[model samples]
Target: MREFLIFSRTARTGGKINPKNLFQEGRLDIIRDFIVEAFFTANKKRSAIVHCFLYGQPNPPLHLTITSSAPVSIDRVKTATLLSDLISKKKKIRGCEMKKESIIEFLTKASKTKTIYLLDKKGKSIHETKILPNAIFCFADHLGFPRKEFKRISTISAETISLGKQTYFAYQALMLLQYFLDEKGID
Candidate 1:
């Protein structure tokens, strides 16, 4: 399955955006559509959609976002380190309490210049590709036909798998936020 990752941002003047309410009852479909349109316009690629869920307080932190791309190698190490470090700081995701401001500050610094790597199960590189700010592309269909039997085209087969798009997109958005916060500092 083709995959992609997206990073989302709250509108500049607004408070934090909560992904949990994205499709609740009203509103966010509009917001999501706008973002999708903007994404396509910016990247010029056909990408599946994913949603994000942000968490925290006094401006909830970004908890999760739907994503489509494979996880970056750097992310695995960073996430593990962050969780462990939080333990030393006496902050916890499940049991203990964490200072929202401090956690945000930490994330902002830890998430910049992260790299994206896609590899096979055997751990071979797929493309060594990295996503620049905003990139997009669409799939292309077959271009040629058989010489003698046009019916042979009907025998051609395609396989499809459902790759949870919203979840992937959300994850990507958070990762991007992670990178951005790490670089620019949160408001």
Candidate 2:
């Protein structure tokens, strides 16, 4: 299984937010791309799970999980719209999980079997890191992780990995990771 856990430091936590205000809430612009890449990569042979951590509201920290097996809408606009609705409802769409939850809650459960890696520019090259079974790659949103969260992640034994020397957008990093997997024959 392949999982992409995205921590959005500026996304609204509750489901009552206005859908049209996602940009105002934060740059949710790349969110769909991240979701799409997670589902389509690795020759479409692996199961994908995208856990979006929204932490931009008063409630703070909403966990939205999207699984690849769920019946996805083909239209990009429809897909995004549906996701926005799900966020507004604070409810699951299809089989995805959309609810209020803490970052630690999700991480604790995910780290049990999956080898978690934190994406960082100062870390070792991702190519050098061994891809263990049931890998879970984590990345923060546009604002990136807070200082305290990064420290907590390190304590959890989540290795910090980088995509070469250059810093790329989160979606680009995901695509690069998929390409690397293809090159390394890791699938």
Candidate 3:
């Protein structure tokens, strides 16, 4: 996932904007020119991830999982709830917290190395959270080692195509995602 500059057009199965129609009607070409001009103007790189989303759907192929409508506290609650749901669905998690000794034992049994990424919302270290020292000591004492391979990232950028404005913001967000997940030595 090298850095990219994606030029995406929405899918057109129904009432959504169709890439074929846009290209045939010459709007996509105009957009392509605009994007190229903007990229040159900003002296930015050309790596991008062009995507098409279906309209009127709860889930898109590529989606922005974060929302601004919820308050901060509610957002955190929602995040925790979603993660809890995932763990429950997997049937692998026993309780709210997996014991650190169990986690270390599992890691020790695995033949292949695993990369555990500890990401906080806004790319802060979970260690940077309150009770950091206590939490670190607890885990260190349990595992006899630290899981510190996780990297911290700041923000994501993206652009949306709407209201006659090119979705440059969504593009930037995609770039940021690529930067975070691509070729950072996960193995």
Task: Give me the candidate number with maximum TM-score.
Answer: 2
Give me the runs in candidate 1 sitting further than 4 Å from their true place: 1-26, 42-62, 68-111, 114-187
Query: What ranges in model 2 sit over 4 Å off?
Result: 15-21, 41-46, 90-92
Question: Model 1, residue 54: displacement in angstroms?
Answer: 3.5
Give the clash count for each candidate: 31, 1, 18
RMSD for each of the candidates: 19.3, 2.5, 19.7
Query: Across residues 1-187, which tens digit of lDDT does each residue of candidate 3 receive?
Result: 1212222223112223333334432123332332232223134333222111111122222211111221112232333333233222333322222221222233233213322222223333323332211010111111111223111101111111111222234324333333333334210
Q: Between candidates 2 and 3, name the one with more favorable TM-score.
A: 2
lDDT of 1: 0.28
Candidate maximizing lDDT: 2
TM-scores for all candidates: the values are: 0.22, 0.87, 0.21
Candidate 3, superposed: residue stretches over 4 Å from native: 1-11, 15-53, 56-168
lDDT per residue, candidate 2, 1-187, as tens digits? 6678888887765545444545664655566667777776433434678888877766677788888766544444555666677677754568677777787777777789778888889988876888776777888776788999888876664688888888788888888987887688764
State model 2's lDDT: 0.73
Indicate the residue-level lDDT of 158 in model 3: 13
